[model samples]
Target: MNQTIDTILNHRSIRKFKPEPLKQEHLALILDAARSSSTSSYLMAYTMIGVTDPEKKSALASISNQSYIKDNGHFVLFCGDYHRHMLKADEKEKETLAYNVQSTEYFMIATVDATIAAQNMTLAAESLGIGACYIGSIKRDLDLVNDLFQLPEHVVPLFGLALGYPDEQQEIKPKLPKEAVYFENTYKDDEAHMAALDQFDQTIETYYRTRSTNQREDSWTKQMIKTLHNRRNDRLTPFVKEKKFNNR
Candidate 1:
């Protein structure tokens, strides 16, 4: 296989990083690779904002609850930038190009495009020895981010990636059994699948018990339950609609 295909298969998220600064050329090259990722309709609807400011990075780190955002040499926020579509419509004298994205297919398309590009960048960084973590918790504090960044209409920050050289090594996280992930032509809800999942849950609990040692939920199922119960911020949909993404 080609080098790019090999890199794609070997991808992993990096959370720990060395403080050494990434060179400007390396930064440009990785970003160029990210931009090379496919975009739906060739709109190039994704935008990555590089953050070099200490305070802003700190704020992002605090929001993400992932300290690596602060420790990394560089922070890059990927966004689903729908504003360009509006600009094009306005300049082309086309009307009815409303930014009403609520429940629209474009919303999902933009999110997918941005996420794909973000992963491409992560792979690019990793291939060059720079570690990185994709931060998703920023959605929790998008209000703080909207005010801080002055985000325009139809533009939403999807996630951020922290970038630096590895200060610490992390093992490859074990994925679910192939049978657990892959399905036949039709989804099979057989007992074998549930059995595999239960086995995997035990495996996850074992890893967490050894790694965390905290008095809390142990299994993957328990963790999923905890997240479902603890996470109450279901406001993102309304917020996105408010931002004119979904017309509702």
Candidate 2:
């Protein structure tokens, strides 16, 4: 297989990082790779905030309750942003032209654009032998995070990316089988879906038991059930609306 494919297949979420900071040239290259990601209709409705200050990182780590956020060489918050577009419209005396920026369609577009860019940045960092972790727990207190960044209207924080040198090697997590995810013209029936889940449960159970760190007797199904049952963060919709997104 090609080196690119190898890199993609061996991906792991790294939470522990070395004390050294990322090289300036590598950081620049990674950011450039993020900018190269495709945007919907060339709108590019997203922004990345690279946090370098130790105080800010400490605040973010508290928000996320993940120490990696503070220890990582670099942290970047990818935001779905339409405020820039609005400013441009106002600048050109064409405020009415960008009236749909708050619509749900535009919100989805910006979110997807930000996600794509973050994935590109992750892949670039991985290719450079740098470790990276996606920090979604920042959403636990979305308002605090927004305030921390001092975001303007029409700019919503989506997630954070922590990049640094690896201090620990983690086992690659197993994913669902190809057959379980990829289907033909029509989606598989309920029986087939259950069969796939059953198979994956066994595989994941084995993985958890065999992994070197945090070994446990659990399956993907159990984890999913627990996660869904305890899902809390009900503020997402309200937060998005407050940011002037998805108003339509």
Instruction: Return the top candidate by TM-score.
Output: 2
- The parts of candidate 1 lying over 4 Å away from their true place are 1-10, 91-95, 99-103, 211-217
What C-alpha lDDT does candidate 1 achieve relative to the native structure?
0.78
- Residue 48 of model 2, lDDT score: 99
Across 181-219, the per-residue lDDT of candidate 2 in tens digits comes to 988899887777889989999999999999898899999
lDDT of 1 by residue, 1-248 (tens): 98778766666677778787798888998988898899888867777888888888888878878788888878888887777777756543434556244447877878889988988888888788788888888788888777767788778788888889888766556578877888979898899889989998988877776653243447877878889989876867777776667564
Candidate RMSDs in Å, in order, are 2.5, 1.6
Q: What's the TM for model 2?
A: 0.95
Positional deviation of residue 145's Cα in model 1 after best superposition, in angstroms: 0.8
